[model samples]
Target: MTYADVFRAEWGQVVATLIRMIGDWELAEECTQEACAAALERWPRDGVPDKPGAWLTTTARNRAIDWLRREAVGAAKLQEVAAMTDEPPPAYDVPDDRLRLMFTCCHPALAMEARVALTLRTLAGLSTAEIARAFLVGETTMSKRLTRAKQKIQYAGIPYRVPPAHLLPERTPAVLAVLYLLFNEGYSDVSRSTLSQEGIRLARLLVELMPEEPEAAGLLALMLFHDSRRETRLSPDGVLITLDEQDRTRWNCELITEAEELLDRTLQRHMPGPYQVQAAIAACHAIARTAADTDWPQIAALYGQLPQTPVVALNRAVALGMADGPGVGLALVDQLATGSLAGYHLLPAARADFLRRLNRRTEAVAAYTEAIELATTDADRKYLQKRLVQVSVQS
Candidate 1:
């Protein structure tokens, strides 16, 4: 059971280390996966090893050694890999190699989607399916994308290390975007919480490494605020709980406080960005003592400050609907029904809520049905199913 957690935390390190050593992404992955399979078979009988990462790394190294011998790549390289031996890397203390690999994966040579997807796949060990869900695409589509990205790296001879200091500015934004997307995956899904925590951990490292970057701090604050309520986001029966219905008393005050303090420092920088504005919106909900106390008008105004992407427009619509009247919100929501959010469940979910609030029970029922039909997670489906029943009876 604990091995699963260790694997999530260590998989990236093992893979990254092997890639660094052998310079073959595919072979490193295969050997590390083989090492994982070996652990599953042995750990239960032999008991969990004291140093799992070291054990796995050594096992993987030996596997690589055997592989190189069979492949007959080169005598010198084979001797080199075989001769390498030392203390295994630490489990958690600021993995430089993994960070280097992250920057490498975020190289501008690849498409933005491919860079983020590849980084999540290689550095975080997230499944292609998980990354696909985050991207709102099919698993097969993402698999091909990942395969192509890796092939691009291999054939194009992109270096697998961090960029120089001068090049960091251009790549930093992409890196931040990847981290934010990673955290959101965790935030929206319960099963991937470890990935979410990894997102936070890496964000903290980025902030520490680049304290001058206010947006990095802002991103970290955003993650903390959302992660604070993780425990209360679901009911005992695994039903999704909306933010308004969440038990605020059970929220982690410490994380919220840390986030607020961090955001305050970020604000002092006087260079507000999209992440800062979004963090400010999260702050409003966090500071409110009750759902009724939430500053919907202020939140709506904050959302207005952001660039009006389809997702942002949808969020603004919800905030406006909450701040003004249901009519105002429903109008905005409806305008987006045919655009980029055509099949997105949240759009219909928001429409259903506004209609429900307006007592348009029949319309609400239909909207809820659409939302539930499109929803992916069981938690979302269950919550929408409950809403559908309520609206149907009312109609």
Candidate 2:
């Protein structure tokens, strides 16, 4: 594999391993970057190593040891590192270090946005620019947020280890939420495929670590269900394709079946959370052989069980529109337009669709114009622009 691929795969594990050994986030990150730089310089000449992760970890650990010895502050920590370096790497069925780092980054003490940003940065190895673009924020803002989060972790004495069984109930939700957001950000944009895959990988790790946590399984199932449609979500020309317009034959049936089985297993646990409910809604779409066969009423009912965030409410309005009528959906969309969702692009987009369905071409044109203005990504903007043209023509 190319050194770039190795760096992407191993950066998190190497940093996590060093952090666990040295108990310093900044130092571990610094040393890991140094190791990556060194690899970039040397690997092309010497050829890729068989065990790149092990090589990177050893290099980073040595750098940490050198720093510790020069500082002479933590002899005990240095000795521990030396001892670890002397021993061969263990062949484990799972790596707990990365999991521990994920939980640490998603600690409840951090702000929700900070938790999501930090997890994407540290655990998923995403650059600040990539993350900023994903969330529609400035790179400087994301950099500052990450810096403050790391400082909080250091100063507030947030433990780096995973929470105990008793504490899992409290801590797991934040972690799951961060992962879910990460997945959604990646899933929404075609250019961010790596981020989506990383999110899925982490979700799978969470399930493996906490087998009894049905929510973890539910989150994984939810992502898988969405991922099953990834190939058909966009056209070959990179234009966005709405769900109803996507070709069902291109959908990954294997992933859909797996997600269905997983959601079924999680539901049998008898505890339904937001992810499980969302997964069920996704399953409602996945199981349908054709767009007309989709169970919109069931999907709308499932949305009712979810907390009424503006986004959920917007989606519920769409499902209600499909199940009931465009007038019903338009009323709900109008109500949201006056609320916190006023500036949201999808709010206007939904309004435009409902208006179009009712043949209120003038209102649809206005709403589509607003949606085009608010849309973030080029694909979304292009799609909205296309819809705007159609509605304007009708008007």
Candidate 3:
């Protein structure tokens, strides 16, 4: 493979392994960058090796040894390097190292915003601008958040290894949140690039890295259920189509089946964690042959049990509307309006939907206009603006 292709495929593995070896996330990232730079210069001439990942790993290892020899010159670390001379060095294939990195990047010890910005930057290769767009924040603010998160890690000495299995259950929810955030960052059209494929890739990687973890399985299932409907979310004219308006024939049956099987297996574990419940909610939609056929009542029930994350409650309210009536959904949306979600776009959007259903055209148009003002993406703005137009014409 070309150097570019090789680096893209193997960069995460090399960086993850280096972080494990060096016990410093920032320095390991630097060493990997330096190694990739060296490979670019040398590989075209020396020719790419058959095992490029191993080649890159060895190059980075040697670079780290050289740095430590000059700076640290310690006894134990020096002995560790010397021991590495006789062997090709073990494959960087430690299980769950990536998961460990995810937790570190999104440690709750860090600010919630910082956790998200750092995870996307370090794990998914997302830029500050891209992350900012995801949350409707300025790029400068996102950059600061990322920088602060890294500093916190450096100062707090967050370990680069996964916690012991006995501690896994306590920590698993945080790990799942990281993966979910990662998938969401990519699943939506927050950037010029379509991250849907990338989201699927990262989800698969996390599940592969932590095969025995039920939360990881739930993560994969959650992503699969959403991904199955990606194509159906857009019209040929590039308009955003609501799920109830989407054509079920466009959904990916294979992905749906895979996610269903995962949901079944996840249920056997029966810890009923947040991700497991979210996946079950998605499964309700996946099993339906049509939007009207969806089990909205079951979805509403799952959402009721979902964690107290505001987004979860907001989503549950939408399902409640579909399952019950606009009154129930509107009450929930109205309740959140005075709470933490006062300025959030989805609240207004949900309010608009309920108003429209009740034939309150003026209020619906105003709510849609507020949603449009709050929207970040051009796609979302256009969607809300169009809804306003429709309501105005009807009025």
Candidate with the larger TM-score of 1 and 2: 1
| lDDT winner | 1
1-395 in candidate 3: lDDT tens per residue? 45665775566667766665666667767777889999989988998988887888788888888888889767786666445432333334324445556654555577676766676666665666767766656778777777777777778887755545455555556556656666776566634233456556656766675677777788789889998998777666667788888888889999999999988887896687777888888888888878789998899888888766677788988889988999889988888887657667888999999999989999999899999888756777877888899999998
Candidate 2: tens digits of C-alpha lDDT, residues 1-395 = 45676787788778877777777888989999999998888888998888888888888888888899899967788899887652434544335555556665667788877887887777677789867765556779889988888888888877776655566656677788778877877787666677689888888888887788888889999999999999898877778999899999999999898888888998987679999999999999998888999999999999999998878988999999999999999998888877767656888999999999999999899988999897767889889999999988878
| Cα TM-score per model | 0.89, 0.79, 0.73
Best by the TM-score measure = 1
| Alpha-carbon runs more than 4 Å astray in model 2 | 1-7, 27-97, 108-114, 127-145, 162-170, 338-344, 360-378
Candidates, ranked, TM-score = 1, 2, 3
Ranked by lDDT from best down, the candidates are: 1, 2, 3
lDDT of 1 by residue, 46-92 (tens): 98888898888888889999999999988887787676565554443
Shift in Å, residue 221, candidate 1? 1.1
Candidate 3, which ten residues in sequence have the lowest lDDT sum? 85-94
Higher-ranked by TM-score: 1 or 3: 1
Residue 368 accuracy (lDDT) in model 3: 97
Q: List the residue pairs that clash in candidate 1.
A: none
lDDT of each: 0.86, 0.83, 0.74
lDDT of 3 at 189: 65
